[model samples]
Every structure is written in structure tokens, then in C-alpha cells.
Target: MTEPLPHPQLLLAIAALRDRALAADSLNALGFSIANDPYPLLQYHQALVFQQQGQSLELLCVSGLARPSEDSPYLVWLQRAVRWIATQLDDDQPRWLGRDALTPPADIAEGWAEWWPKGLWCIPLHDRDGQRLGLVLFLLDAAPAPALQPLFEGLWRTWAHCWASFARQRRLLRWRPGKRQLLLALAVAVALLLVPVRQTALAPAEIVSREAMIISSPIDGVIQSMQVRPNQPVEKDTPLFSLDETTLNSRAEVLGKEVAVADAELMAASQRAFDNPQSKSELTLLHGRVQQRRAELAAVKAQLQRTQVRAPRAGVAVYSDPNDWLGKPVSTGERILLIAEPKQPAMLIQLPVADAIALEPGAEVTLFLTAYPLTPLKGKVLETSYQAQANEEGVVAYRLLASIDGQPEHARLGLHGTARLYGERVVLGYYLLRRPFAALRAWSGL
Candidate 1:
């Protein structure tokens, strides 16, 4: 009696079951089926995927044909087995089927019982050109029938070919370029090569003298009025502001009376001293009184001056906020304004620390203003700070002063511009620009 080839329907059912299990998205579900199957001598199963960037195989999935438990001996052995296989593949050894088997330890069956009770099967996934892409490992739940080998092998072959074709298509898609893209890339490469780099120059600068004065009141009084605004330019002795001088005037009157009395006394003592030398003591005392009165008068006059603030120089007036001024009856030592000389303009250039180190007091530089790009100003480095300051970009640069030959017609303070420093220049032919493209071609194997 011919045992009808294991019923075709049964074979179809078995194939479908295997396919559905393999297609499971979750490893836990796959493990459940492998565990529940009544296959003794069950061992481990794993899948390894190739990483193109690292050019190596890494474990993608793992399952055991035994119960899941942290203390399971099989788990430890399986890990060790995977490690051994990974080492072999990483070295590109011929012992591992030359990348044919995705799973590590290409000879899975030989070392299977050493780690577990049963053997394992490793299937390699390849592309259409037979390039290895990944691997799959399976542990038997039972001694798989000799007949099962052919069935499983056929299943692996079908999936392997499909995966390979898909991989080949992906590789081809990456290399394909559209017309617009090709043109845009070529344009960028040409621009990088053809554009001439410009040289940066330093700007001019000058040193200006500065001074400060403290304006205090001799008499306590309320603020009468403010005569100057912040940043109002004023010349030396110019009226900065005024204060209420009523109290000061009263004190001046008292001091004047004392001075007059002292002067009369001194005169009488001097006449007496001339008539009689014995009255010299009284004369001496009178002279001392006169000196004291003179000093008092001088102090009164100084106090009177405090009532009116004045500029000490022909510069811009700088006014400080009232809150910052130390509490006093009137503004004391408060900056009213700053007067800067507009005729003498200086150029300030901030250069990177590295570049600044190369610059000297006489180094020449060219300056260009953002507003007037047509005009290029020449300047000579006059001074550089010993210390470096951090610019807005957080890069440390040295502040340099340069003297511009002639200020631009529309030059203004706080203008934005770039300074080009003429460093060593190199001469190269225009055709040499194509070197980068050639190198890229070699790298891409195109």
C-alpha cells in the first residue's frame, strides 16, 4: 500500500503554520509556539541581521524552545553560543559558511547540546546576487523528522530569495538621481570651487582722555531744577545743572559778617602792636583769627559753587540715572552727559585671538563698511589690548585700534563691517577645483 505522500493537504497546513509563526511581529508569541510544541531536546533559536554601517551581524531576535525563566540554564548557554558565532562572522571567516548563515556559530548543530539538550539550525538570508544580508536560527522542540528537513529548507529558500530581491531594489533606488538633483549638486560644487575668497583688513582706532568730578552740596536743600539732559555735550565751565541756593546764601551771609569782624579786630591789634611791642601777643592772636576767617570765607565760596554744576571739559555730557546717584540733597557726582569730539573718529577692530597674535602696531589693514561697500578704507594698527574679550558669539578676540586715512563721507559710529587680514595666499589653477569631485567618485565606487 503506497502511503499517499504525507497528505498534500497536511503538508500545506504545516507549511502555513510555519509561515504564520515566522511572520509573528512579537518575539514573545514566537517563543510561545516553539515552547508549546511537543518537541523534546528543544534548544535555542535566534535571528541575526546585518548592519551596513558597521559591516557586522548583530542578534536581532532570540527564542527558546523551553519555558521562559530568568534562572533558565539554557539562556546563559545560548548567549555564550551567540557570542562565539558573532566573533567568527566579525572576522569574515570561511568556517561560518562565508556569511551564508545569518546566525553566529555557523556550525550550530555541533555545539547545540553543549549549551542545550538539542541542536539548532541556522538559515542565511541573501540578496539576489547571493550577498549575505541576515540569518535565522531555530532550536528543535523535538528530534525533527528527517522528512521535516526538506520542508524547512524549502521554506527558507522561498523567503531568502524574496528578501534578497527586496534588498537589491533598495540599493538600486539609492543610486538613482533625477535631472534637477544632478544639476543642483553640480552647481553647488562649481560655486565652491570658483568663488574667490576675500582678504579681511583691520580698522583704525584712537585713544581719548577721560575724567570724572564729584558735585556735592555745602548746604542741605531740595533739588531746585535740572538744567542739563543725559549725553548733552558741554564745554569746560559750562553750566551742567542748578540747585536751590537759598540755604547756601544764608550761610554765606553769616560767614561774611564773621570775616568783617575779624578784619576789624586784626586792624586794631596791628596798630597797638606798632605802638607797644609788649602788645605783640594780642597782635599774634588777631592774626590767627584773620587767617581762620579767611579760610571760612574760602569754604563758603566753594560751597556756593556747588549750587551750579558745570562741565570741566569740551566733551559730551553724560547723565547717570538718579536712582544710582548716592542719596544726597541734590545730585552728587551724578554724570549729566558725555560730550565726545566728533571730528576725530577712530576705527575699532576686534580680531580673533589667533589672528590678533600675528598683528603688530604697524600692521596694515583694509576696512569695508556694510553701508558703503564701494569704498575701501586703509588703516594701520595703532594698539591692541593685552587681554582678550569675548564677542557676542562667545569667541575670545583682542580689541585693536587702527587709524583710518580718511573717514567715509557717510561714516557713523557703531557701523557693522568686516575687516580682512591679508594672510599668506596660495595660487592654484581653476581646473584643480575638480579634485574634490574626483575623490568623491572614488569613494562611492561610481
Candidate 2:
């Protein structure tokens, strides 16, 4: 400015000012620039600065480069350079030259050789207190002329004072993906361990009958007439069917005549005994004849009554066949019909033994018929056997009976359904906890 500086000096001064501006901008934009960080914009700016200063630059300390030990001769030379720069500043302030002759602290120097190699020049960055904070290692493709050294030194002095502020902001704003992922995984694990899980509910029951029987005819003859049809309600002594009785009636009439004559003879003998006062032999013979006639009469009457079959109790009559019965004959002991009383209707179920024991007298039962799924019929536990019986499939099951509550309109005498016997109501937690163990036991045949 005073009479203008010489041409080379003016050029040098402009380049240094440009580089200073660039360094300040990079510090504002990136906050901090580490030695080996691959920031393209910062690298481009550094290239500009190098071109303005008439120096050729290269970057050697990139992230993926191979490493060398800290004790190498090259690092020894760097320590010497750092010592020389430290002596140039004022008493309270320190400086650094971008050269291999600067020494770094032991902690920072330990991994330095691996992060940096040949051609890297160190510039010491310092805070307001003149304490060394970090080092910026610039690299060059060829040795710089001695003339550019003073410009670099002046730039370092200006930028080094701002390093502390830049570093603090960098530390606060940094995003470390690897560290964040580790913390997230740890949090997930803790949440899983703390969460509580509940148990399962109880399983449903099963029920079977022990005293089911099929009724049959005892003789072979034409039905003649049917006194009952399928599902017909009847009471005890109700005539179920009647065979043709023409032949039986004729035999009964002859037996009645013989009985009448025997009675007349017996009466004559009794009167004679009273009149004569000593007719013992005649009385005995008359009594014997009377007994013979009575026996014959009873036999014929039994035969006649056999033709008419009657129901034993109040029940719904169900014929074995529905085609016809008015003129059909059924053989002895053949199952021609069945009468199922409402009070004694068959309550069949296939119950597990463990459940059967819990079923006591008067235990509540709910029946769900396949025909009427929506309509639930009520019942009570009538009986249960202590021992288990092997079913047709050879599976052991206990027999049980439940008396139906009201006469359900849709419940046919022989209808099939499932009977849900209500046992004790327990905590839902117990059933869930024991379910797995129970299943395991069953699978292992324990």
C-alpha cells in the first residue's frame, strides 16, 4: 500500500489473503476439518489456495490409506518442525508451519504415522490461551519454494485462534451412526425384558352314556295293528302293537267252558260234603279237577295277552322301521321298537376321566344339539361312574348321565348332542400355566 509493494510481494500478499478467507469459510461451514477427513469442498478450496500460491498439492492422509508406525524417521522430522514454529510466536502464543518438522503430543502422535505419511506438512492450531488444540496436516506433491513459507505461516497464525470454537461446535453436532445403532439395540432389549405377559384360558369338557339299550319283540306274528308310531308319546301299560287274535280267542273260549264246568262240579262237591258230613275223597278229587282247569285257563289267557305288546312306562315311541306295521310280523326278541321316556332319556357323552371325577350330583349341564345349535338346553348331572370303561375305539372314558331340565320342543328322544358339564370355575391363570405341562404329559403318555 505504501508506494505499492514489489510485484512478487503483491502477488504473495493477495494469495495469502485469499487462502485466509478460504480457511475461515471452511471453519464456518464444516466447523472443524480433521487431517484425514475426505471433504471434497474443503479439498477443492485447498487446491485453489495451492494454485494461487504457485505450489502443487496432493492429499496423502485419506481414510482408506495404508499405515506406517509413529516412530518412523519421517515422524521424527515432524517433531523438529513443530518445535521450530513454537519459538517464533510471542510469549503467550504458539505457531506452526505446514512442514514435517513439527512435534505432536504423545497421545495425538501415537496413531499419527498411520493417519499421515510423506509430504504432509503440519500446521498447529491454538486457542486464545495459546494452548495447542489440533493440527492440520497439509500435503503437497512437490517441495514448496522457501518464498511461500512466510505466507503459509501468516495464514496459520490468523486461523489457529479460531480452532477451539470450531472444535467444540464439531463435537456437539457430530452424528455417529455406529454408536447410535448400539444404543438403540440396548434399549430394545431392556424393553422386551420389562414387558409382562399373561396366561391362557381353560379347555372345554366332553361327556358319554352307560345304560343304553334297544328293545325287541318276543314273538313272530303279524303286527295286525300298530298302537304307536315314531316319536309318539305314551304312558305305562299303553298298548304299543296288537297281533290278529282270531285263533287265540277260539282257544280262550274253549278254556273258559272247561273252567265253568270244573267250577260247577267243585260247587256240587262242596254242598254234598256239607250234607253228608263225610265226603273227603270226593272233595279232594273235585279240588284236583278244579286246579287243572284253572291252570289251562291261565295258559290260554297268557297266550292271548302276548299278542298285544304294551309300553312299560311313559315315553316317546320310536319304531325300528317306518314303512308299515299293520300286517307285518316280528320274530321273538327282535328290536321292533324303542320307547324313550323324557325322564329317562339317554344322556350320552364321552368324558375324560379327570373331568368325570369333578362332576358330582346336581352339577349343571348345558346341551347343544347339532340340529339346534343356537338353542341351549339345560340339564343336571344325574350320575357318574367311578371307574372308566374302554369305548369301542379302546379309549378309556367315564360314563355319565345328565337329566334334562325342561322338555325341549326340538329335542327328539334319540337326538345326538354335546353335553357341557359345568364344573368349578377357577382362575383363568391356572389353566393357562398348566396347559403346556398337561399337553406335554399327554404327548409323552405320562
Candidate 3:
């Protein structure tokens, strides 16, 4: 059988609708075209268009209306009914819907009599990929002609493509925050900055004796040799080191010879006193000279005895390699080594002046020794220097003394490591910005 050809006027209406859908610049404009532009081809009492929003359908346009009023009863019922309808339709194809054809839930069925016609055409709009994007409902007074199906399918395809493109563009655009949202975010940031945290600083530290006896050079002379090894245990009166006694011995020998000469001259002058009265006056001068020489000789012998230094108390000898001290000239009272008790260990920290933070006595300190970095030792600050002094490394730093909390086996004297010193609690912002602020103040002199 030959199918009747589409009327020329009807073909013109479909072309016009397709052009209108293609020219749509926005989702709203496309929705309006979908809802009202096909009136000439299919005489419908009203048309409604909806798009998929998450798991629900959102009504975008209503025929003959500039904008669908959200508060309208008809729209309210239609939104719920349409969501129900979308779930029932398994395939993205044009179909007819009637109250008798598919029984809706009680709530939707109650609104049908007042808001909808007894029968309507539901056309699902699909993008090129075959994914349903929206739905268009047409409430026609009479059944749509079979010839109109092809025209409607072509027009809906154009509408779906335009809608999908707009959707993709909307998703790509960034969401600009309103004034209230911005203020809320700022408040949250301020709150985070106000959180309290412990202020901490890291500095070089070493394990030292808490109450070690200082071993210093007794006299000004070159060191001859070390009597004991570094870190070797020593008993009281033990020989620790000795100075070069060559100069002292030579001085003593000279003084002794002078004393003997003075004594011999005195005896000779005494012997001559009996023979000649003039020699009696020389005897008194010679005797005085002998006494002065004897005193000088005694002083030299005493200094010679002091050249060999001994440990004043029993403890371990703490110092650098003995080779460093041999032949080194040392002044009187200059420290050379330490006689430290093994049990009395403490931490000595050299915090650089630039990194110095306010610290109180008894502040918590954690020591990470280079020898045993995995196991950290805990301690508390006992004292700190008021002024910055140049350390062994030539860095100007404040000296801090800390006592070990417990006698840890690894807390051996002379061990070097880094110390993390924790001071008073402060706001997180202040803790993080303290160093930067200090640098800025120093640079700006303010």
C-alpha cells in the first residue's frame, strides 16, 4: 500500500521547528521551542518540557508561558507525576500515556483529573549517543497522525543536541561564590588560624656532664702528652695529662747551680773571715745571696712538680682526641678536658640567635642523637644564657642547658645531635609565621 505524503504546509512547519531548535542559544530558549514551536504540525492544548536533573525531572518550560511559575499547583503536580512517568518508561521512545494504560501511584492519580488530559503523547529526547536527556509531553485534542512521527523525531534530535551542549557548557563554568559564602569561608580560615599549638625550634645540641669537674692547664706551657685516653675512666689523683717539663727542668738546674755556688762562696767567705777582717763584711753579703738563691730554687722545683696534671676526682676523662692536645700550648686555667661522672648527663644546646624563640625554664626538649637517631631522648631546659656567644662552629648562638628526664642508656656524654625545643603555647598562625615575622622585622628595622 502507498503511504500518503506529508502535506506541504505540515512539512514547512517541521522545517521551521527544526530551524528554531537549532538556533536556540540557551537551555531556556531550547525548552521554549520544544514546548511551543510544533503547534502548527500537531494541534495540542498544551505542551510541557522537562530535563533530567540528577535522578529527578525538572520542568523547564510550559507552552504559552514566558516562565513556568514554580508555585503553580499544576507545575507542582506535574513535576511529581513526570518523575513517576520517567521511571515507568524503560526505553527512550515516543509513546502514548493514558490513566488506564499505566496505573500511577495514588498521589499522582489524584492530580490527573484536574491538571492533565485523559491521553497525551510522551516523546523522550535523546542525544546523539542514545542517552535520554529530556522528555516532552504533548496534550493533543485528537490523536497525532502517523505521518507526524518522523518529523517529531527529527525535531527532538535537534533539541536534544542543543540541550546537551548547553548542559556541558554550564558544567564547565566555575561557580562564583556569593558575598555570604565568601564571608563564611573567611571566618572558617580565621578560626583555623586561632587554634593553639606549641611553638618549637630546632638547634644543635650535645650530651654533656651536668656537674663535671673542669680540667684546666695549671701553668703556661706546651702540653707534653696525655696520661689517659679520651673517655677513659680515671681514679682520684690519677695522672690525666702533663706539660713539657724541659724548660722547668733547665730553670731548676740553673737555680740549683746558683744555690750551690752561693753556698760555696758563703763558706769561703766565712773561712777567710778568720784570716782577714775585710772578708768578714763579704760573709754577710754572701750569706744573704745564698738564702735568696735557695728561695728561687725552691720555687722552680714546685713549678716542676705542677707540670704533670692529675685528676682531682674519680670520673671519666671527656675530651677530644689526645693527639689534638699533644704539643699544644695552653695558658694557666685554660680548660683542656672534663672529669665527668657517667651518671650525670645533660644536654647543651647552641640555638642560633636568628632562630631563637622565647623559652622558659623547664621547657620540654627532645634530643635526636646522631648515633641513635631512631631513638630520641627527652629532657627539660634547666638554664639558658642571656646573651648570644660564638660557638665552636663560629655561629653566634644562645647557650641552653637541659637535664635528661631519665637515665637512658644512649645518653652518653660527648654525643652530638639536634634538639627540638618547645616553648609556650601560641596561636597556630603565630607559630607558623614567627620566623618570617622576625626576618621581616630585622630587615625593615621595625
Candidate 4:
């Protein structure tokens, strides 16, 4: 007589053991390899997992014969079935059932087994500790031959043990923190949450002059010379720089000649008018012309006088170099340099848009100077910008003005530092989440 077909369970068990022991990545082929074998004929074979913590069922793998991709509709229905069956798995009782006995909704159950499967065997896969790892689902149109029962039991037990062992390894690999670590972390979190502190925002800051003045060109001209050196102290009306006066001098000379010519013509016209009555109007017109020429001459002389630019107040000439001004053409109203009295300095802060802190007047400010990082000085917010503008650092930011307090003598003008501004007090957690939560709310419009 012809030998009967070998049992599928035995074949798959051998395949699983050999593939795993040999380090071959052939697990992806095991399901279909067994299903296609004409041993204990099966319509479908699938592996599913049940998590004790999540209490959810998920399809892990399927027989190669009818494998579903991750995004398949059958897997979708299977997920829904797992949720429905989660409650039914109240106990560890082994189960064997027909299609009608399934707790899954009719459509999902019937649809998953497209041909309305006749029977299903639910075998439990557990660990050495007897913890349930998952289940193996085997579908068939008829019960296996009685002679094959022993082989089926032994093979399935081996395969199930294999899967559970692998699952345990994965769990161990993803081990969570121990109780001591968790407790320590919890304590630290509690302390941070309860401790009261200032809600501060940091930005780059510089010591700017409180009484700063800008000296600018009164008219368009080229710089001929500098009268005062950079950082030189000067009194009000002290000459700062001299502009080229070649064109102005020439124009003044022309106006003077015109004035003289007009004066001589007026004199001659007066004499003619005294000799004759008809020349009176001519004399009057000549007189007005002379006055106009004199006015022009005076205006030119005034411009020529201003060529020597002077300091407006008692302060230092704060330009970098005298060489920068010599022969440099400047437009009217263009700033040449600054004149700031060596007095109390103020803080100029540029807070980047991303790091903006809302603070009202009198909010505490602390500065750490670049020259002396260890030493911190104090200040108070004096003003804040309503809108963002680009600062010298090429970043869009809100400008802040602050009054320095208890500044040291070494903290001179233009000294750069970092400024920290404290806003209204808030809990540590709230301060940390404030920006991210605001961003999320703005993005979601919730």
C-alpha cells in the first residue's frame, strides 16, 4: 500500500528548529511551507500574540499560502477581532471551535476565512514560567486523522515554545528601568515641580550709552581731515572733523564778486537818478539786486563755516579711527560717529523671536559680561518692543531696554554680555511645556 502523507506539524517543527539553529532567516517561509505540504491539510495557518499588559491581539505572521501584507484589509479585520475577543480570553482555558463558535463579529470571522472554514484549533504558547505568550491558529475543513494527534501535539508544543522563547528574548532586550531608578526619577521630578523659581529668558546684551549722541554730516561733502581722535574727550563746540571746502570756497568767491558788482551799479544808478528823474526805478531795482547778492554771499559763508564739524556736548569722540574719515564722502544726515558722555550705561538686549520672554517694567535682569563671565551684574527692564525687528546680529528679535544697576567701573561702553530677564513666576513644568504647547495649539488651531 502507498504510504500516507506525513503530518504537516512535524515538518514545520523540524523546519522551525533547523532554520533557527542554523541561523538562517527562513522564518518568513515557514507558514506557507507547512500549509502547502499535503500532510495534515490546512486551509490557513497564522500566528497571533496576546499581550498581558495591553490585553490586545495582533497577527504576527501568516502561512505563505495566504499571507497578508501589513496594510491588508484582512489584518484590519483581525485587529478588530482581537479587541472583541480580548474580553472572551478571561481565563487561560484551551479552546477548540467551529466557525459558528467564534466570539468575533460574523462579518470579520466569515470574511477572514473566505471559504467559511470548518474547524479551528487554538493552541496556547507559554513560557517556562507558564505565562501566556500567544496562540497558534490552525484552520482545516476536517479534524486530523486520529493517528496524527500525538505527532500534532508534540510538534505544536515545540513550535510554540520556540516562539515564546523568542518573545521573552525581545522583552528582555527592551527591559524597562528598575524600581529604584524609577523611584529616584519620580522624586527628582516632584522636587522640580514644587520648587519655586523665576521664569527667565536669555539673550545677548550690550552696554549702550544712556546719553549717546550721533554726529552726522550737515551737507554732502568729502572729509578733508579729522580734528579729534577716537575716544578723545571733547567739550561742546570742539571741532570734530573738517570736510573738503573747495567747492564752497569757490562759490563764496563768486557771490562776493556779484555783491561788489551790484553795489557799484547801485551807486552809479543813484548818481544817474539824481541827475535825471527817469533813472529812479532803475536805481531801486539795482538796490534790491545788491541785497540779494549779499544774502547769497552770507549763506555760502555759513556753509563754509560749518565745514569744520564740531562736537555738540561734553563727551568722547567714539569713532574707531581718524583714517576712516579722511577723504570719505558722506551724505547729509549720515552719522559720522557717536558722542556719549562717560556716565551710567544702559543695557540693549536683542531677544530672538524663538526665545522671546514677556516681561513688564521693573522685571529683574542679570548680565554676564563676556570679559568676566563669572561675575554677574544686575539690571531692570525699562522698555520692550511690541514687534520683532532684525538686530545687528542678523536675527529677527524683540529689542529690550534695561537700566543697569550697581555696575562696576570696568563695565564700560560697548561691553557685550548675556542678559537673562525674569518674567512672572511659573511652575517648572509649566515653563518647560509653555512653548511646545503653544506651538502645538497654534499648529492644530485647537
Greater TM-score among 2 and 4 belongs to 4
Question: Which scores higher on TM-score, 3 or 4?
Answer: 3
TM-score of 3: 0.60
Better of 1 and 3 by TM-score: 3
In order, candidate lDDTs are 0.56, 0.57, 0.88, 0.73
**RMSD of each candidate relative to the true structure:** 11.7, 20.8, 19.3, 9.4
Better of 1 and 2 by lDDT: 2
Candidate 2 has a TM-score of 0.37
lDDT of 3 by residue, 10-88 (tens): 7888888888888988988888888888886777889989888777888888899887689988878887889888876
**lDDT for each residue of candidate 2 in 5-101, tens digit (9 for 90 to 100):** 3368545554555454456544533223233232231231121011001121212222323443557765555455434333444443222233256
Writing each residue's lDDT as its tens digit, candidate 1 over 199-304 gives: 3334332222123344444344555655665555667888765667777788778888998999898888778888898878887788888888788878878877
Instruction: Give one digit per residue, the lDDT tens place, for model 4 in 313-410.
Output: 89877877888778999999999999987686889899999888768999999999999899887889998899999987689999899988875786
TM-score of each: 0.48, 0.37, 0.60, 0.58
For model 1 the TM-score comes to 0.48
Q: Which stretch of 10 consecutive residues in model 2 shows the poorest summed lDDT?
A: 47-56
